[model samples]
Target: MSAIACASLSALVAPSLCRALPALAVAPRLLTAFPTATRQPAALSRRMVTSASLTPTIEDILVEDHRQFGEIMRRYNLATEKAEKKAALAELIRQVAVHSVGEEKILYPILEKIAIKGDAKAVIARERQEHKQVRDMLYDLLDRNLPVGDPLFERDVEAMYKYLAAHCAGEEVSDCPEMARFFPESARREFGKRFLAVKKLAEDQVAEEILDMESKINL
Candidate 1:
């Protein structure tokens, strides 16, 4: 009889055995769901490593950053402690600022050039407006210096999150993919490198500002 049938029979004939029967029935499914790991030959593993090390394109970099930013926001939302939430919020601010600036400085200019002429100005303008709204909200949050748990702070953070989520969705759906089509693979890779460099520079600037603030506090 099938394991499920056995389980049903056990339930009918022996209630105490029914629970154990279900476990027996589920065991094979659990094993199938998660196969046991096995060591591969060293040479095969090394080959796999080489294959995995291939460089990512511009789209890959942007998409990965979006994913990371989403994760930071998630961490901020899930953080129960004030200190933990503050830290997560600060990191999220830095990342959002850097990512927006990098796109504006490096990515958007290329996009503008490659974009269809009639729509280019309008698209770039709209994206810039969205970025401006986010930055304005961020500045307001920073200026308040309120505890993360404060009602005002929570409200502003939620607003910022909603705006950012919408902006990211638009870029992922329309902007990045359209811009990517205009560039050759080699040029796209180069753009990716430039994007990272610009983002790093922006992050450094934010770090310096943070250090300046902390130093003032210590003084």
Candidate 2:
């Protein structure tokens, strides 16, 4: 989305949506343009990194997660049939788990190595704790056989989604610059490939776990 569209969106939406819309609108541009405002010329030159050299920094990846989460929330709100909602919730659970694990496996370690004081390692550390808590809730949801909208499951899923949104914010504001610093061009290209490979492995692991659960249930 363009700046004009964002400005238009801000005028018409509630404050909360207004705040969130910028990331939704601007994220793709940020990935491509890597705007000077969010990144420093020195950082870019020091790294000699171009947009194509990296797939997406943790910020970009998390922005995509937020977009997906927002879509799921919107679908859940609009769903009328119990079956449909349940299916949507199941899909949401799958996506969120995959996203979280991929980030933890591929992104956080890099952040921990490069993070500096003003870069908000404290916030990122707290967010990592939140990820563990949220992952526990997701695992509980995975183990349950209950219907969708079961109070406990719904509560846990909502909590996890909320945590993700806040977590994404911290990463974008606090940890993004560190990414530019840590992932200079050659390193970014190599890490980008590794990140995707790890994410694919994580997805396969989730599939295997689901299969194991299904076998145990004779389903």
Each prediction's TM-score against the native? 0.68, 0.61
What does candidate 2's lDDT look like per residue over 1-219, in tens digits? 233222321232222100000110011112221222357422332333347644654445555565677798779768877666766666665566566665666566665544445334555456556666665555555577655567765675576566666656545554555555444544544455555565565566676554443332211
For residue 84, what is the lDDT in candidate 1? Answer: 78
lDDT of each: 0.56, 0.51
Clashing pairs in 2: none
Q: Candidate 1: worst 10 consecutive residues by lDDT? A: 18-27
Q: Which portions of model 1 show Cα errors greater than 4 Å?
A: 1-54, 210-219
Please state every model's RMSD to the true fold in angstroms.
Answer: 22.8, 13.8
State the TM-score for model 2.
0.61
Q: Let me know the TM-score candidate 1 reaches against the reference structure.
A: 0.68
